[model samples]
Target: MMTLRRKLTFLVALAAAIPVVIMIGLTLKAQENLVLQAKGELNLLMRTNLAHIARDIYALCDTVNDVVAKDLDMDLAAARRAMAKCGAPNLGVESADWDAVYPLTRQARRVPLAKFMLGDAWLGQSRDPAEHVPVVDEIGREADCVCSVFQLMNEKGDMIRVATTVLDETGRRAIGEVMPAVEEDGSPNEAIAAVLRGETFRGLATVITNRMFSVYAPTQDANGKIIGMLCVGKRPETIASIRKAISGIRIGKDGYVAVLGGKGRFRGSYLIAPKAEDEGRNLWDRTAKRPDGSEHHFIRSMVTNSVAGGGRAIHFEHYPWPKPGVTGAEIPEKTGACIYFAPWDWVICATLYEEDYHAAADKIESTMTSLAVTLSLAGLV
Candidate 1:
């Protein structure tokens, strides 16, 4: 038991284990620090991206509103006349005449022309064929005003209905009026509703569906009746184009970018893997649950109450899962993930295999292990 060879072997083994343990501990600490740093960097990048996206959207809305407002004066009387004369043969009108009428019709002040026309058509009962007539009638009666409805051709060369209403300046009882029925989808109506409710609705970046961001704003008429809404919308392709452009910019291996809503919902996401579903999913709904019935610490950090203000940026964590719009705390962890939030409730999140982001640390740990083994062998020799 007291042999010199045995004593020497024990001493060498102790020495090797001590350094190896120390090396491993230090490596782990460094890795943790690196990961934290990476997370911070990614969050910052996400915040910046969101700010830019918001700015662009606001600008686009402004441009559209300005163009429409300047071009058409929000006239109800002219819209009424046009509706009455719709489908009249020859209409005895030229393109130039139609163009001339455009400015005059747009310039008319808001009035109850549609309500009067509707009452006249239905004898105040239900003359209009559209099912939305009742709703339009209700809006008209409540607001006591009317607005301008525009006819424009879509990419499909089909005529589309677009309407805009400003606060009534005249002491008229018309709140708003519906445009003549057009063939396009009802996205424009949704957009107008959002504006009326004081929400910002803008085109989002996604090719699969038309995405929009809704923000709230106040409305006031000449009599301060707050008669209706003015909303602006563009194609979702606007945001998709931006995301595609950013993808061309390199970050690191597996590096990506995303745009989130104030509610931490995915407005736009760019990842290596394709997404299964698109639109209307919330990020906070996803991150709060785990498979083993245990909650992830990272996701819990991102939850918070809604804040006021139009465009203030904030920072927080995100948990992905629950599939956006899910209610309650019971979510599967396989559905949970962590992300970072920026001001304005914009979020950017990323998760990849450890090797993708920490290659350098991995290599260093491997080298240290080899050194530990070599030292132990030399001691035996």
Candidate 2:
């Protein structure tokens, strides 16, 4: 037979263990649910960011197309067909060759370029502060958004800024300058190439110092041959309000949202990060090795999974990132949800340290243990 002390000890042990077991079980279940909910919310955020990017691009495209359709009265389909046969424009080609394919004289007479030029000249000479040139005024009116850029390019891709809400360093419109054949990164620009080929190009591309979400549409002459391009661009900073809003979302201690560019020359590039130093870094090439000394190819795997799942929150993987301003030091075990936004080629991730979750469970356990001890002593007395 057990002594009274032994029986009391057994009861106390049982009292202590029961609630702890229940608490642990409940904590595990709650943690699972919380993680799941967080992942779902992260996926929604990724999609929302992507949609915002697409909306900016589409809005720019619509603005340019509307102006071209209403003012120029050119058929876009016929223009596309005609542009298909023109081959790529040789920027260095002789004037004779240009005249043979795209006659400047005929186009000048047919379109409103001459009128806009006249208006530009008038605006330059006019003393009246409120006097707006007719064609320039029309374009300015269409450029409703601040920081928007609208340009009419010649067949040679020389751009004339008819109206711009974006200003140069001098706070004046960049008028009558040839658009650069290449982007700031020195890559042949896909958007310009598409328009030059007489096809509409809508995508993200770098313009000047700012990476812009751009839309390039072919503007044609009376003969339905592509004569020029209508370009509308908005800097990503304009749409970065979404990122600014989401950046504050914290997932345990130091976890935050991170954005990576998924396509174009900037593919695998970091777009947004809490650490300023991490921005613009190539994520795919900068990944750390796995525990087994194998290359994890973190960026590639994340992009592939997110793309395949159509931006769904696919999986959580261990992500090792260097601590800011600390060399050779990495976060022990950080995990993140990978999601892709196809429209802007963005990879959005929300990450948290695994230890944080464990700590919460530990805290609950500690509290339960204290409660059990108090109850067990009372029963013994």
Candidate 1: regions farther than 4 A off: 1-209, 212-220, 246-255, 264-284, 287-293, 296-345, 376-381
lDDT of each: 0.35, 0.53
- Return the top candidate by TM-score: 2
Residue 247 CA displacement from its true place in model 1, Å: 5.6
**Per-residue C-alpha lDDT of model 2 across residues 165-233, encoded as one tens digit per residue:** 445455555433345445444555566677768787755554444655556676554556554465555
lDDT of 2 at 373: 62
User: Per-prediction TM-score, please?
Assistant: 0.38, 0.53
RMSD of 1: 14.4
* lDDT of candidate 2 at residue 76, scale 0 to 100: 27
Tens-place lDDT per residue, model 1, 258-374, is 334533223222221224254344443333445788866442243332122333433333344332355886642221112323222333332222333345556555665566566
CA RMSD of all predictions: 14.4, 10.9
Residue 337, model 2, lDDT = 73
